[model samples]
Target: MLIRILFFLAFLFLIDWYSFQAFKASFPGNFWVKLAFWSFSIIVYLFVAYTFLTFSNRGVSSPNFGRMASLLILSIIPKLIILTFLFGEDILRVSTGAFQSIAGSREGDFLPDRRKFLNQTALALAAIPFVGILHGVLIGKYRYRVIRHTLEFDDLPEEFDGFTITQISDIHSGSFDDRKKLEYGVDLINQQGSDVILFTGDLVNNRSEEMEPWIETFKKLHAPLGKYSILGNHDYGDYMSWPSQEAKAANLQHLFQIQEELGFKLLRNESVQIQKGNSSIDLIGVENWGKGFAQYGDLAKAAANLTKESFKILMSHDPSHFDEEVKSFAHHIHLTLSGHTHGMQFGIEIPGFIKWSPASLRYPKWAGLYEELGRYLHVNRGFGFLAFPGRVGIWPEITVLELRRK
Candidate 1:
């Protein structure tokens, strides 16, 4: 927990530094500009903070309010100090260079008049909050758009052609207190012309009862090949307060019962055949496989009763499963589907720079669809959030994959 909190702070610092640099680069050097930048930034921060803090304690006493106000002041003081240390220099250099280029009306660098530069820097600080809020909305509300794109596999076997798989991952139902939202997502899924649907795990977060309210809504999802599901890291009754091992076992059993209630065929180290006209392909699903998490996915176990000649599509939640476990499995899975990485909830994708979120740096195929070694893997950005409780650029996903014959 301490490590996670530290990481979050470090991430915020990086964002502030980058934004400061960009702001500095865009403005012209002037005293008024610099003063306005800094003063406006201070005011924006204080205003937002005051608004939140004021409303945060609605029925508090005057004494309580005094203490809370002191605490708020203390907190902002440290953040201001930290912000200067973290971003002060980077902002100056980037801003000066930017102002010179803008003044000259070309892409060249030169130092700005120090006094004027400082003034502009302060003004730019005002713009910072606006930019920060914008960045927050872009990353939080739209991050998934970059990673969530419609994929068409032109070489899919004819048997599975046009097989649109409406995938939802990392539902984390425990975090969702509203049934109406779940129903909306479900309704959207049902409306998509999907021939088959795959739910790549993390269905109920930690407990079976978390999904109880949405069982009827989820059951409404029906396709010709039906809805199939696999387990994700959170599905194994981990990260919870259980009375005993027996209680955990009972929870898992109840989870299976919920899957049955929701009309989803739970795939646990097993294979099923989906028939189409005269040909059929194997749909295999395995237990979650992730590094340092559950290492229970057995490729051989999933293929035990299936033929080696079968055209296979495997649903395994973690993308790491494909890169590590299934990439070289003997049966040669032609297509693998997964989700788990929500694209770090931030990033930019452009012509020369696909500055995807830092999360992708840790996991190479962290988002979107990719192919390697003659096998295809599509990683869904996910339909929900976990710790942050909101997406940035990576929004909730509704993937519709079109499979075409080779």
Candidate 2:
């Protein structure tokens, strides 16, 4: 944490220095420019100090208000500073680039053009802040917006083809500091008329108890078929310090019970055949099986009793599991669904450059639908977030997969 703080400070210093340089170049490095720069620096420092002071005492009655306030201020400061520097740099770069281009052509005198170049660069730099503000607003509103969409797959088997399976993964129930907000999300999920529901994993952030308030609310999500779930990394209490080994084990056990209470059939390396009329498909849910995480997800064990002749749909928490092991496990699995990535809570689904969340660097199949080695994998971006507590480009997802036949 200390290292992180120091790194952040260094980053701020770099941006500030660059902005100062850009301003100097733009304004001829004279007294007015220097004075203006110093004045701005002092004002920014005092503003930050005042923010910290108020942040040091967030609310009159809230016990942890100070910490909360500090966090909020800390989170906003970097963006503020970055915006300032960007504005300065943009102006400088554009002006300089234009001046250089004109000078090279020998179409005009160089000095006036150079000054124009500098001012243009400064203008370009200033545009960065405006862009940052626009991005922040868009991301802030879009990230947190609750979205519900129903998707139908034409390749699903005829029997379960129209089977409306609603999925919500990476709920990170523990992350919600507000009960009302959580309840609202839960209510939204319950509203979907899903025939069956599958919770891909990471139900809680870390602690099993963190999911207490959500269990009952989630139980309201009922289907004629059933509600099923699998484990994500956080469900194992791996990130936090527990009292003892027994406590950790107990938390996991309690989590399973919570799944049961939520009316979900917790599938840990197991398979169950769900019959619809005369036909049936195997629903396999395995433990966390991904790169650098839990290696206990046994596809072989999960599909042991199931036959390859039957169509199979799998619920595995991490998408990388499909990449690393699913294809060779058996030909039984036709579709695999996962949700640990949360698309890093940010991403852009643009053509050609579909930049996924930061999690994509770790796991390539970060979000939405993906196919590899003839096997299909659907990576749900996730229904919640982790440390940042904001969705940004990626919104909370309640996937409605309508299985269809080819």
Candidate 3:
């Protein structure tokens, strides 16, 4: 723990030093100006370091502390970006001086101190990410978008041909800061008028109590068919320490009860038949399952009663499950919905022109739709932010999937 703290403080100091170098280059030969800049930089660094230490000691149980700490980390991202460009300039300057000296040029004739244009350019480039992050924290986090997709299936039941499903995942209620904004998002979900609502999980960060404040707000979500849900890794209370195994068990029980109270039929490796007239489709839901995370999901058990001809729609928390197991199952799981990646809660997405997130490198099917061998997986970007306390290019998502018969 002490080593970890030292490393964190060192990292902050490095960022501060680099920021000072960049600033000094821009306003060189002004002793008072440089002193002022140094004082301001050190003050901010010390404050952030102190906050980090306090939060580390106090624990992450409080949502406010978590938000503050996340914001502080985010604050360094712009400085780091600026530092990269400034460091490159410094390297070039050093190389030029070394080459001149080797060629017998005097010290005074070597490369000049620091190019003002280069420093200005660095600051200008850094502003882009700084402003982007500010927007993410202030606006993008609550900018809920309803992304619609039409998926066709040759074997879709005639009665359920035009069925619509609205999916919202990774609620992480603990990170929410505004109730009014959350209510607006909830209203947007209801506005979709989806036949059924499917929530792939998270719900809370580490404890069931995180959801207590938002129960009534989420309860307002209505679907004519039903609302079904399954757990995400976060819902298991595995990230936090408990006094005893029994206490952890009780916390999970309370989470289950909270889901029930919110009118969500929690499915734990279970299947439910949704009927429309004479046609019916099987909806299978499994507990949280991922590559390195928990593997509580039982695909076979969930699809046990369903026949090979059953048109199945699966709700699993992580998209990794689709790649690892669901597609290879005996019965063809026609469509799988998941949302654990949250697009890494950061990335660039532009309709059809481009869609990219760092999350894709880890989980191949990080966001949107992916198809393989006639099986489909739609990974929702997520409905809430987590450790980052905000989102950048990847805004909170509300997915409306319209099922059509091919």
Candidate 4:
């Protein structure tokens, strides 16, 4: 742990020192700028070192850890951007130095002078994310967007056509500190007036009790039909240490009870039939089942006695499960709802122009709706932020899905 911390600090120092070169290039010989630059850099480094040195197993439940992570992101991302350009500049400098040394110039003075325009351009570009991240921490995370999507299916129950369902995932209640902002999010969900509300998972980050404070606020979410939820990996409390197996088991049970109190029919590898008129559709929910995550969910058991012809909507936390397992199941699942990947909590998403995030490299279907083999999967970006404590371009989402019979 200590070695890793030292390595991280070393990396930060390099980024800081290299970035300072640009500062000097841009403001050549400005003593005050140099002092302020190094002063801020040293303070950030010291604070980061202290944070990692004093780290504990408080896990995701600790707000301090989240705050520290946010600070690091805000500090490092812009610097990394600056480093990108600076690195290119260094390549040119080194190449010039090599050529000058071959021509008999003194080795130390071989490199050419810093290009002010190049350094200024890098600084200007880096400033974008710096201000953006600052705004993300202050306001973007609380910025809730309601996405309305209509999915059409030939087999959709006629009665259920136009049936609207609101979906939100990854609440991570432990990470919530602002009651007013949280209440506003909940109120926004209520304002959608979807027939039924479905929460894909991650109600809390590590412990069940983390939801204690926000239970009432979330309870305000009203759906005409009912509210339903399933477990996410974090809801299992597997990320944290427990005194005993019994304690962990009790914690899970307590979470279930909390969901019950909040009026969510917590589904644990089970299926429920939603009846409308004479027709009904199966809403099967499984425990956290993903390729790299916990596999407590039993799909066969959840789909027991359900026919392949029956239209089914699945609620699984991780999108990997949809790609890895749910797609090829003997019993066809028409639609799957998931939200494990939080778009890495940062990305540039433009409705039709471009939608990109670092998370796409890992999970192709990281967010939004996708179609495969006539089946549909909608991955909610998430209703809350996690470790970083702030979301950049990908704002908190409240999805309203309407089913259309074709």
Please, what is the TM-score per model? 0.70, 0.73, 0.94, 0.95
Better model by lDDT: candidate 1 vs candidate 4: 4
lDDT of 1 at 255: 93
Which residue ranges in model 2 land beyond 4 Å of their true spot? Answer: 1-11, 20-157, 350-355
Q: Each model's number of backbone clashes? A: 25, 23, 0, 0
State in Å the error of residue 262, model 1: 0.7
The whole-model lDDT of each prediction reads: 0.68, 0.69, 0.88, 0.90
Better of 1 and 3 by TM-score: 3
Candidate 3 residue-wise lDDT, 1-406, digit = tens: 5567678768877887777777787877889967875675566556656655666422454555556555565567778888888789889998988899889997695775788888888878887887888788889899999999999999999998889999999999988889999999999999999999999999998889989999999999999999999999999888877889999999999999999999999999999999899889999999998999999999999988889998999999999999899999999999999999989878898986989999979988899998999999999999998877778899999999999998
Say what the RMSD of model 3 is: 2.2
lDDT per residue (tens digit) for residues 131-212 in model 4: 9888888998999999999989998989998999999999999888799999999999999998889999999998999999
Scored against the true structure, residue 356 in model 2 reaches a CA lDDT of 58
Least lDDT summed over 10 consecutive residues: which range in candidate 2?
57-66
| Collision count of model 1 | 25
How large is the C-alpha RMSD of every model relative to the true structure? 9.5, 7.0, 2.2, 1.8
Q: Once superposed on the true structure, which residue ranges of model 4 sit more than 4 Å away at CA?
A: 97-109
Which lDDT value does model 1 have at 76?
Answer: 43
